[model samples]
Target: MPDTSQKAGGRRNAQSRREDQPMYPATLKVAVIHWVMLCAVASTVAQTVDLSGEWRFKKGDDASWRQPDLVDTDWQPISTGSPWEQQGHPDYDGFAWYRRRFTVPTALRDAEAFALTQSLLLSLGRVDDVDETWFNGQRVGGHGTFPPNYAGDWQAHRSYVVPNALVRWGEANVLAVRVYDGSGMGGLLGRRPLLRAATWREVVRLEWEPGLGDGLFTAPRPIAFQATLHNDSPRALSGDLHWSVEDDEGKELSRSTVAVALPAGRATPAVHSFQPSSPGFYKFVATLEPVDGTKLLFSKFTGYLPESIEAPLTREPDFDAFWKETLATLAAVDPQFAVERKIDRDSATHEVYEIAMRSLGGVRVRGWYEKPKTGNRSPVLLRVPGYGQNMRPTGSDAPIAFFSFNVRGHGNSQQDVSGLPADYWIRGLDDKRGYYYQGAYADCVRAVDFLAGRSELDPQRIGVTGGSQGGGLSLATAALDPRISLCAPNIPFLCDWVKYFKASHWPEMDKWIEARPERTWETTLKTMSYFDTLNMADRIRCPVLFSLGVQDPVCPPSTVFSVYNRLGGRKEFRAYPNDAHRVNGAHRAVLNAWIGREFSRPAK
Candidate 1:
């Protein structure tokens, strides 16, 4: 078996705090303590501790033993375990065990005085689900059942307390674990488990980087505001920063424009102070227009202006020019046929419309629309599909105007763009103008437009739902438009993009790293911020339901929690330890039941 244990002295040195990094003055003391802890942990290794590694594994359905003290020669090396990649073995549903042997270091013989702990981390990739972990011959900790039907915890980390008596100093120790993936893309997609000496430093390192910061709301003041733009790139950049303030009616209040220049590797903060003549709720936006005339970067920040002044609309006739050009470009391309003619009928209980929207970008996007057959108008349910599939409403009999859409490069909607191989991660990657996410957002808006166009549809009662990528779209759409009344995203993707690159091993994301390898981590993250749900969650005006699987390997529960905590509206969440990407049958029942009740009620 290959030794998977980490080298004791090979760990990277602790990182020093970057000078340019922002810090909350009040938390300086806490930050200092974290640095100290990292230093101490890096300097020590526990003596007489047996670290787990050199693992072997086997596939099975039974969990009869908590501790496998007896050796089974039938077991194969975990690295070569069954269910080869092509078979999609186990179909991402089933059970497997990992066993490793380790020898204790003789440095500390008084093992009983110090606590021994074991921890395992798994990454299933894309899908979120539950898992159960074991150590040596004992049940340690797991979110789901020890053997079957375990409720999911959806957490990336699982730990087990080591019995003091189980420590055999200076001897070989066997560590074993059992993992279960219930749905979606499940399996060991990235990273692996290894052993480390547990100490206070380790505990402190875990505590460092206090989750996310709270939203800071400035007191109502003059509309005048200053923006400090920092150009942290190596090459000189030039752009025009367009600024505008708008009222609640979507009317412009005041506007200013500035052209900016920054030398290579420098910082510049532009100050814009303006007074609004009138206000309800105001927004300030800054858009970058590059010198080469290429739309390289587009960024904006919003704030409110007091309603005391009577501000008039500052009309910019040129604004429509951009929209006109965009619309003209879209009209030039023929919309590819998405679906053939189907039946449109009204029954006693439902009104069904066989609908088809062209996949202008090549990926065919298709779906069905069903409304209440009765005279009463029905709310819309905009369902976003997960990775590799188009949205298709399932297991529901409610009267809903369903608009299921395929993102730009998927399904029947592939129009102007070439068809991407089912597994192409970098498809449409080189050109940001045609990237999957760029068109995906547009698809969401088009879906809304389609629903709103129908006279029988109750636009005010429309809602959105999806899992994984679909869940992410739900949050993004809700933030961009207030028309959505409710949203439910399950194990959503594309939250904190910066953190995702560090935590995930999804092969598709490698294109991002390759495009800008030197500052790929930083640049890709900044680009992702434009699409991050955390930044948009505050803008959402509707109620939301967020679900997570504790044992999920792809979308870590912690990341989901980070976004859920930032939501600024009515919100509720559920965590399943044994479940993965798709919730179990029982949980799905609860979800649909809640939706039926909420959607049926009159809008607030």
Candidate 2:
């Protein structure tokens, strides 16, 4: 169970109520509070400089902005309005210029000068790619690389500094933006991209009245946190609030009870205090128990803590010792398949090598490798970039042989495993044997075999890493084959099959669940145990590096953390708060750095 006895210190005092505070305030205080609230509302609803008017756009190979001096019309607006509306055209694959004219307020001429900021926030509410911003024909900051797949999510609001000279403070200003959407649903499909002055309101107003509040909390202590409940409706509502807490390992810690009786249109705050005795990530769930004993109004919260002196680290061996024990355990299970591999060659520039290995079926699997150019025979990293028809070697130079393998169902090896789609997730999910995971795992084992066949690569210096379904393969390979030196899986899917089937809101999984009503979750999950990374993570011997995104609806953070805490080996984890499955370039850099460092260390 979690330890909830830790005192709520200065962090709580920042917003907690004082014992001597009055329930209601004096007239003067009330007046001041009302005035403040009114001011806040007014600021939120203040006139927004709508920059969505008629705009001109052009596409070019270079960044040169054609000035009026070079064009026929100096003041006329050049429009590509019709062609721009027809999205998804092959011509839309490149950059385009967008021009919008807005009249500046004359009264605000002398007011603090502000530059126009253009941001693409939440494109079409589904797909997210990268884009750039320009104001008055001047360059501003942007996230990600230029052109398609620009590295930044549409949900993220990017602000770039505009030159003061470019701003027509009180006159009409021309705002142009060059956007690039690489794949999937490209272009601005939903709402228009927003353009605003530098000085704009940022506070978000959340109104709450009676059943449940937003899923946010502040953990004053390791195990205990407080939550606010509000009743927005005009009637009193009564319900039992059930709260439960679980650690990263899916171990239930402590839970507290609370009953709420909120008046109509009034708000109530409930504080949950639980004990989290562990020093890892913890999840808290609050549910409004139905009168008929059903569950409703569910919300989740997560918290973590650094290691403390009082709680001695669990009696787990260090990474090397753990891997040795893991190998020994797996060896005890089946001595016929010893855990060892060999590397053949190490490249100088491209870091490419070749490996040959005999699979369990006695068929040899081939692999291409790329090791860190740092001149060190560091731990090896085996990667399978998924079933794409053009899967290639990734991470050419790092601290390890970032060997990316094209599994049998993908790339040059597709003939070996046929009938699988280039994109396999949506293909034959109902069939247990023919499912993508089946062949994928075989390819993973082959990858390890290829590594073992090599003479230059170290057998004990092998790790596996990948994302999405590839992540699932990493876990399965590590579980079925103990030769993997370390494992790093990022936002992997296909874990905790029961929970995933129930919690996922995606169309693909929803269709699968509905079509297979006869397939009980228990049966499906049992079958999935063979592929579930979380279940397999515990079986992995090497230290694992896990990364998760808090806002990822696809592979929810809860599932990731569930597997992370249960891993019975040396582990390190990081969560990007506002990111989804595909993280930003900066975060990717951090992940690469961590992998480099982990592989650089000598095997224990």
Candidate 3:
């Protein structure tokens, strides 16, 4: 069995929390202030000045660039809203400098609340690679270390606090930034930058939690997506807590406003009941605002009984007939399955073979097959590849057999597919019969056929698992062929196409629609209906273990849920709230042991 000591304590159904993962905090902070109000808010009123605009830029770094009054006659103009690469230096990298001039209103020095604080907050959105900033020729703040260390996370937000004494109020002041990018797109980017008094977090703090500890609420049970609002100030405050529940597509399902009175220095619980008629993911957004207009906002995601969420089949009437005919066509061609031993790569415990066979439309696919040298029949696991990815033999020392298969257009299996990934998605979009995945799915079926025919493998104990596009392929393969005894998919694609389009964008999808003069979106979706995983979920009766990253944009959590909620029989899912399009090391250990245990069980 795979080692369980890595993480999640190797628990079979652990939803591991990756709290350390960085999330891009909303940098657009309105005045975090105490307000002079007819009602009440904070004791300080925060005024903000937007500093996001065109800035003088240079490709190379120089210590002299930080001067407040340098004649930057030849420096190019660049906007802070986007990376420098997108402006004019698409291929340029390394050190760069950005400078701009602005005034911090002198009137702020006379404001009643201004005397309460000693610093002004500069919100710089996000910077790629690394950045160092200077306000009026003095080092202020920066994130990441410059080379030879060369370490910086592009995702982190950039915020600097400037001492109140440094401000040359109502006078022209220069702000300069030094940036270094090792490679890829780089520069100041993301949200609009601003110079504000403070952020809402500096005063009051807000946090959300589901009513049920596991966040799975039964239908009509009156569940609450509750929030704890803490009043950090010594004085009391009053406000209306507005709560809204949104569906997976961002459609507002319900809203409520409750007046809250906070006692001095105490945390108050804000809650509202939301009843979901069906199972699916939902988001809760809360805004606590007083009459003075100081607002603190926070959001959290949760789901109901996921398996009970109903998504009706959007398949065409000929869905079964279409696949039946495709398989028949594949059956007409001889597989010509062949395997050759690789003596040099064989481990002490197993032997390896380079395998290939003819699949649908006579497209030849390739894979690596390895078996233990115990001279006993072994349960084989089929591992598929992600989009445009090739397959390499895994170096695992497990006793089970492994068949790493690559479809046409991926890795060594590309015999007919030209171009690359973008071309593959749009190819033959007008006709379902000619679509690339039609043959690719058939290629997976042929691999299973080859496995069942092998004497050294137990056909009844076969399993399939993959991530991203491969995750979708595993679902399709298991649905079409019963030989797969266990199925595990992670951050999967090819499910729920209609919602998929709404949640994520693939340029190839746009290109396909634009190139064809007669093809409308309705017609295009009809073709996709034939391949959507939700329509085929009921066909696979085997137990399924699925995982998804809540932050994954490529194959979003919504797309995973559209199909996952419809899955019947034995199934469970683990969501990594902070991950994006990839599985964690802890989940990997869990899968290893789970798969090992599943394969070793008695097959029905």
Best by lDDT: 3
Deviation from native of the Cα of residue 458 in model 1, angstroms: 0.9
lDDT of 3 by residue, 463-543 (tens): 898878888999999999988998988788888888888765555567668876898889999998999898888888888
lDDT of 2: 0.49
Q: How does residue 604 of candidate 2 score in lDDT?
A: 74
> Would you list the C-alpha lDDT of every candidate in the order shown?
0.50, 0.49, 0.74
Off by over 4 Å in 3: 2-207, 211-214, 228-242, 256-272, 287-297, 340-348, 502-508, 550-569, 575-580
Lowest summed lDDT across 10 adjacent residues in model 1 is found at 1-10
Which is the winner by TM-score between candidate 1 and candidate 3? Answer: 3
Model 1 C-alpha lDDT per residue in residues 133-186, reported as the tens digit of each score: 555566545554433545543334454434335556568766665555443223
Question: What is candidate 2's lDDT per residue for 96-135, written digit by digit as tens?
Answer: 5555666655443333322211211111111123555556
- lDDT (0-100) at residue 568 of candidate 1? 70
TM-score, one value per model = 0.45, 0.51, 0.62
User: Model 1: runs farther than 4 Å from truth?
Assistant: 1-341, 344-352, 358-364, 393-395, 415-419, 423-425, 515-519
Candidate order (lDDT): 3, 1, 2
Task: Superpose all Cα atoms of candidate 1 onto the true structure and report the RMSD in Å to 1 decimal.
Answer: 18.6
